[model samples]
Target chain A: MRICFYPGCSYASTAGYKESTEAVCQKLGIELVVIPDWNCCGATVMFGENKLRATALAARHFALTQAMGFEEIVTGCNACYATLGKAARLLNEDAELFIKTKDVLQALGLTLDRIPKIRHLFEILTKAMPDAPSERYRSLSVGAYYGCQLTRPHQFLDKGGYPEILETFLERIGFAVTDHSARTQCCGASHAVIYKDECRNLSARIIREISDKGAQIITTICPLCQFNLDQAQTGDLTPRIPVTYFTQLAGLALGLSATSLGMNKLLVSAEKVISRP
Target chain B: MNKASKPNPFTSISDIATINACIQCGTCSGSCPLSDQMDHAPRELFALIREGEYDMALKSNTPWFCVSCYACMVRCPKEIPVTDLMYAFKEIITRKRTAPKNQKMPDMYRAFSRIIKAKGRITESYVMALYGVKHPLDALKNIPLAVKMILRKRLEPKALSVSDPESFARLFELTEKSEDKA
Candidate 1:
């Protein structure tokens, strides 16, 4: 029940992902040891900027994880998960790049002999939390949003296009899972910032689809997805549906108070939904 | 070597021979979430690559429009690694400074990269400010949301840096040196 955690750049800043994740992990007796002095995973931008640098950036975390006496690196952000996973896969397959990355790490007084396994926070929660202890949240319906990077290009967890793992987890945790097609839809990713109007349309489309499917609330695994979906609902003509992190819901299922789970950080208020009798 | 004689950048990151195996199927294009916004769809870019139209392929906003969703990469009947190809395109374009003038994604990415390169971490507000310098109106539009986030304590005003700054800086330098040799 112990794992090395990589919170990524946005984890601490995003809506209650860090808070609720820490709270739930503490409750579940899962020790999350954060990688000390960890750098950014380079996300998607670094690879496009320079492949070697991106690989080295992510590989740095792998070496740190190994130093921490862990074989796996668990991250809450999809970008970090994918970026680190890509670096690991590349290092494993491309010996030349691996040597170059190792040399780079060596210069910084670090070693990269072995790559660490990358995992999402969702994967850990699904395995750690048992079926809901109480049926308090059974009436609350959740639209599970997987974002884009979690399963696609890597189907280790579930089918890329239409993943049901999140739905299965939600159902097991006693929340009603709504079947929806926007599970793996892109929330415009980082580009949502530069192309606001266009990305808003994309996020809005996902929100509209989930809402139309009769989902009272939407749950997201990635911070950016939750941010894009929540912010897109602002000034939106449709009824506001709260977009929350999966950790927040898991916390609630464990009978933790909403405030303690950082539920108040949501842009569209979940007060009404969580407060329901 | 002249521009035409220069090796295709795609070959450096991935096997062009595999990408050449692209059957011109539009599965990649059809699977792309932002194909409508792209100047050329993923399949068309591959066709352009096959035709020795590297200039056109590099100049297209198709790569920038990619959100790295990898839908096309996973679903490509040919297993062409379409998403990785987009990254290769982005790297080449970024290196050569040849991104299309209409695309701001390159600048946005540069802003993001600069923050990480400096602090080894990202401050969301700082990144937005740096990226927003070019698009003041866009930044203006986000102020309300930013205010709400700040109120919720979700957006940190201060930038966070790694504890070991010396090693973090050295990593970048060493990586750049290694990349130069490569």
Candidate 2:
């Protein structure tokens, strides 16, 4: 199965998102064609600062994807997934905004007649592995964190109120899925960089909630979510639990090497979890 | 209530009608993860916007603190696009002639966009260099993490510029024109 892949800025920078995603895709026999000349999704700040500019930035990517002739594009980052989804929805719904975006694209001789389907890599992983892995892991309890964007303002991926997509995936792969309420909570995202102290407090809440629920390893689909939960531990009151990408867990289940999954680079090491008997 | 003399800020907002749709049931504030840190929660912020207190809404720090998580937007019973409403406040506040031009938050956002304007893609290292120049002490505190990232081959010292600079420049120029109409 071949699909267009948009490895957003953090894919190359994130610890396990790119490595594990590629390794898992290879194991699953999914050919991920990199979107040529791909650019940033303009993230939240862009949309907050100016809607039109944000829409134009994302529409440019859409036009590029359309040119690639792929009807669907997959991304591993929640921010990119949400930003591009919002842009695509806005482009389809708002004729005025669409016209403005088309006019801007026309200057570059590019065109975006329609929005392509924006999918998170989690959806792809679930489809690729329908049953328990041949090489199953010890039932390590995993808290499947969806962050906020992946399941919010849109519930196509899963039910927004209480998302179970991650849980279902984990359970199917032979891990004990822990149902935590804060699974869809905010991680304070980019604000972690701007307002560190406040974001730390916000991130701390999510970490505590997940940890208190007996999750040995908190697995997530978003890079920023992993970064915040993994790095937000201040040694004050919160216990440091390992946070990792869902792809990494899937790669492990598929019998991929930890080195291939970039497992060692994780801020909070998952060595113990991987070595589970 | 806002002063009656000033033009209604609520009406001026593109999505202000959604503010009227708000039941003031406090779902937005309750769902907000950072409401504890907010001086005036989303409920009060909506009230302020409804009262034509755009000045208050703009200066309340609510919009700045918003992470764009969309939790509140999803939970709203009235189906209001609450997050977009927050962005409206940001846009309105940012447009004021006397708004703090170099405030660290918006400046950082503008820097991110400008990098893309110039290079057509964001380079994390470049963003850091530019941000570090502005807030050196803050950057210094994160040296250990930066070192870890560098050791992991995450920080590419030089990133290739976007394939089509001319097109990016033209699109960005057109963006400014769209902003005027927006």
Candidate 3:
């Protein structure tokens, strides 16, 4: 099936997300058509900087998808997904805000009919493969970290606390999903890049919780979570547990090569975890 | 007429009225991950809003440290959209230019906005450089991590510009004009 894809700026640079997502989608026969000349969703900051600009920025993408005659636009990044979703919610509910956004779009020779359905790649991938996977994880313990944006403010795919979509998806794919308390908690989000010390302290709490749950490796859907958790490793010389993208795990089950999926680019080496393949 | 024409920072925010709907339940504060670090937790923050302490609410480090997790909103009994409220506070702080003293967030947001404004995309490498230019000491401390990322070939140092820059530029210009009108 063909669908409009918003790669969300971070997709290309964040090692395995794009690569593994492509490999898995190709295998599953999901054709990802990139939206032409898409701009950044401005993540969480833009709305804070200027609400008008942030709404228009997100609505611009909605207009592009609607202009293409498609109703659903799939996003890869958690922040992008949340931003687009929030903009859609606001534009529909607030008439004044909607008119203002529409005015801005009209100024640019565009019109936002409405914010189209914004979905994360994980939801799409999970629905795409309802059948049982032929492969199994044997005994690898994986902690599925959803982070903040993906399942927040508006439990888009699942509940805010203890969301089971990713966990169930992991189990269905035959991996042993570790139960952890930090499933929907914040991974310091993008603030880690700014307030390094403070964000790190918060991130430390997450890593500690996930590790204490006996997870050998942590699997996350957001790039920032993967970066923060991986970099949030303690200074002491204890072995670093691998923090990997869910796409990489799915790609592995689909029998894709690790190198092709950009597995080597992960900070905490995946050698010990995926070396089995 | 001049006072009427003045850009009231409060009205620019889409849903400032929601602050009144906040029930003052401590759920927002209880749910916040960084409550201890915040000067006024979400509960107290909303109380400040009702009390008309906009300056205090904006000055507090709470919004800066929010992480935009939305946990509070999800768990709030009033469904107050606590996180979005925090985002509104963020906008107020940024627009009013009162981002507390020595906040890395306001500057980072500015640099981040500057980069996105120019290129229409987020290139982490360039953002890092731009941030380093602003905070040289912090930049120096992160060099080792930078080198590590570079060695991993994750640094696509070349910035990616949007296909048509004129339209994107016009969008910003129109947005600013709307702000002026507001």
Model 1 spans > 4 angstroms off: B1-9, B177-182
**TM-score for the A-chain in each candidate structure:** 0.98, 0.96, 0.95
Model 2 TM-score, all chains together: 0.95
Q: lDDT tens digits, residues A1-277, model 3? A: 9989999877886758888989889999999999998998989888777788998899998888888889999987898999999899888888888898888888888878767888998988998864446455647888889998888878868887878998898888768878988888787777777667766767777777877888888899988888888877858623378898998888877778888788888888887776652
lDDT of 1 by residue, B1-182 (tens): 56567667666555457777888879989988788898889888888887778888878999999999999989988788888878877887877778999788887888888888789998878888998898787778779888898899887868989986766877777766433311
Clashing pairs in 2: none
| TM-score, cand. 1 | 0.96
TM-score of each: 0.96, 0.95, 0.93
Best by DockQ: 1
Runs of candidate 2 with Cα error greater than 4 angstroms are A234-236, B10-12, B97-103, B180-182
In terms of TM-score, the best-performing candidate is: 1
DockQ, every prediction: 0.69, 0.64, 0.60
Residues A163-182, candidate 1: write the lDDT tens digits.
Answer: 89999998898999888888
